[model samples]
Target: MRRDKIAVLVPEMEGKIRILLFWLVVMSAPAFSQQAPKIVSSADTASIRIGEQIRWTVAVEVDSAAQVIFPEGQTFSPLETVEAFMTDTTRKNDRLLLQKTYALTQFDSGGYILPTQRIEIDGKGFFTDSILVMVATVPVDTVNQKMYDIKPMMEVQASRWGWLKWVALGLLAVLLAGGAYYWFFLRKKPLSEEEAEALLPPYERAMKELKRLEQSRYLIQDEFKQYYTELTSIVRGYLEEEVHISALESTTGQLLEKIELLRDAGKLDLEDNTLRQFQNILETADLVKFAKSKPELRKAEEDRNKVEEIVQKTKEAIPEPTEEELLQQEEYRMAVAEQQRKRKIRFALGAAAGLLVVALVSAIGYFGFQTVKDYLIGNPSKNLLEGEWVSSSYGYPPVILETPEVLYRKEIELPPEAMGTIQDLDAFAYDDHRANLSIAAVSTVFTKTDEAPDYEGAVDQILAGFERNGARNIITKQEEFTTVSGIPGTKVFGRGNFKIPDSDEFLKGKYAILLFGGNGFMQQVVISWEEDDLYAEEIVDRILNTIEVKTVI
Candidate 1:
């Protein structure tokens, strides 16, 4: 009886507890909904032409204080992410709306499902719905389109710098030849026998010359005057060297007077007999030569022997040099040797400098100053112009052209309004910031529009784009341009000052834009570079000449 009573009571208590829990969940539903995040995913289009961009966006609304994390990395497979934009945030009372956009594209025609993306809000994971996208190939009506013959190749003239190498080679050859000639032929040589004898001491030299004179036939042939003249010259040269007097320039009387003065001053320790004999010999030579007085051959020989004796006696009379005087003489000799060494070094340096200058001048004369400067310093523009190039076609209404390097495909980002009208946007570009050069090719297909792209409006938009990217002081000129294949287009070109990013410095630049519109598609080719780059200018011209668009018949 007691167990039955307890069971009945327990059933009544369980029923009451279930009702209470149900009411509690009902009351808390609104609060839980308010705290939960709201997530949404969308794309600019569900379909696109091959090589076109699709703008993918994801939005999540959460409490301002809650942390939200979006899917990262290459989460969207089968489709490539070309560019990821910054998240846009907006405040709605106590909640925040975060929007993240990405530019995606596919190179092949296919159908793909954009998988559901996970959004984390306050440590809880929520998901968005999957989306379907279709990519279609660009249609080409080959059956009705007319075919043209391939154009013949035109000859390209050789560069003007071809002869510069030869000129440089010639200059180098001249320098080498000149240096060899100087080293081998014009430099100092060893002394001969006569030169070596001339370097002997005054007394020895004088004695040697007297013996040589005796060996001569002048005395044997009775050439008395000549013999006396030769004999007196050797004596005078000896006196000048040994005594430091101007014996050769002085008269015989003046020469003897100088010697007497020296002896009186105690500078000369010569004996009276030696001086008297030298005086007699000098006076006799003067009379024989100037007065036409021919002395006997025997007398000439005696005079020569006396000259030898006088030189020997003079050398014996001379005082030995003091230590200080010897030191002074040694210093003077060393100083002279140093000066000669320095002179030789200077000469060598000057020769090398001159050779370099000559070579530079010769190169400049043949190749022009700018060419030489560019070659020596290295110009990127020149290298691009001369390097191998790539020829390729880009976009829907294909633009066929050549470039120094292949243009990289880039995703085009457009606003919602622009995406509504433009079905496909393909952009390919190359930029060399260091060279301040840019090249771009763009193509756009309108979504079944009745109107064509306005050429003038497009030109205005391009110019406006330049301004937005730091271009100022724009000057423009427009003209009609026709391709080699007879497709007509508008060309807009001008100069502008482009401000460098994060700096006040501005570089003057030139730009050219070619616009072609047909049916519902448009093609554009833009080229810009620093105004002073001649090589870039040439490259631009070459690219322009090769630009062609496929026309729909």
Candidate 2:
């Protein structure tokens, strides 16, 4: 029975293994037979006006087993992508279709060939076909209207917040500096009791110190040196406090000399014997300290006793103040203390004012006087008007001008039609686009046209080119222009709606175009900025006055 059961189990196991192998073969077969992912890229329009928008769409197809990963970001260069939409997912047959769309625009009027964009499917890279896009200019009518000079630099109001930030920063710096100074220098440590003594009459204060010294154990400890030192200190302090003597700072010999002088001057009235006795005690104490001389215990005790007699006798000899005299002394002391307090206050104020003056001067020296003035007066145009101006040659037949900042050379290629009779094209721009201001110059040598560069024809050609680049509804006023160096040219000023590159939306801006040169080539300088910026008017005026144009055939 066991053998028969084993035989049936072997066939069952073999059949199960065979079925698993068959399914594996079926799954592997599709991996080999499946074709590579198919990608299709398309655009709603092949052409757009400068600053006008266009939709670019890309479709990606992948098998159900393969994951489709789409490109994300502004892959189109020269042409800017202003908007990106989420990929739309769909299923057709057994393949998955993933579609992504982008909104793109160009600020320049020209033909651009977008390079092949890479797409990835299942870890493999695939490229889309390169496409050509022609950007046209915004249209303007120059036949019937007078052209205007470029409006002045718009007086852009300096944002108070900008000044506020610097002000706040300066105040913070001052506060930090003051705090550190107080912490390290001006702030006083609290006084201990000895330094914070109570206000007492001079005699009483000297007496209190004497009593305190007597209570000390220097005598009992046989510390004769310290004992005599305290004894002499009490006498000298009493003389300085009650008798108006400089005895505390006097030498033993100096005190003897001052004593005799005081007696002669009637400033002191002690007996001659008392003076001799006091001198002997001071001399003996000085010997112990300076010469390390040891005195007999008997002599030291005699000196201690003499110290008391001298203090008492001297106290009695000093005349007591009358009630009126006490009042006058009090008033004098109060006046002196008040004067000291006022002096301290004046010193502190003077120091603070000095710091403030230093800070002001430093700000002027580092940031310029005009910058500080503008911050104080809230003037935004002062810096540009009074700032350092740089002069340079730009483009061929270089348009020499001075600007607050240097102009950057930008390379541009003219199409065969735009070139008509022009050659050797050069361009320079000072557009930091984020600011919405653009200044550019184009100089080209004409090789195909013999017609002298007519004033009206040149203005029309410039206006047409501006229109092609997305300027529309142009209102212009034209006048004969002379540069700073006296190069004659035609200046065209106008305001128009500039189509946002790659989008249909419009932004109103002011423009100034200068056209000159007649021998063989033409020179053009174009400046454009947002129309709402009134401060730009002055900038245009200042730039034109400083410009020196040179044209060559």
Residues 32-115 of candidate 2 have per-residue lDDT tens digits of 878678889988898986556778888988887787666666578867666789889898888788899888776567899876
Q: How many clashing residue pairs appear in each of the predictions shown?
A: 0, 40
Per the 3 Å backbone cut-off, how many clashing residue pairs does candidate 2 have? 40
| Top lDDT model | 1
- Candidate 1 lDDT by residue in tens digits, 1-553: 9999999999999999999999999999978867667788899999986546789999998889989888787788787665679989999999999999988776557898878878888888888888888988654222224535434444556565647776986898788868756874477778999999987988888888889889999977777788888888998898898888999999989999999998898778898888888888988887878898888767777888888888887887777878998999899989998997777777777777797799899999999999999887878898788766778878776788889888999987898978888899889999987777899999888886444665655677888889998898776655667787677777878788997767889999999999886667778999999999899899999999999886541
Q: List the residue pairs that clash in candidate 1.
A: none
| Clash count in backbone of candidate 1 | 0
User: Which segments of model 1 are wrong by more than 4 Å?
Assistant: 1-233, 239-296, 305-337, 348-383, 387-400, 405-413, 421-426, 431-436, 444-454, 469-475, 480-488, 496-509, 517-521, 530-534, 548-553
**Overall lDDT per candidate, in order of appearance:** 0.82, 0.74
Model 2: how far residue 272 lies from native, Å: 5.3
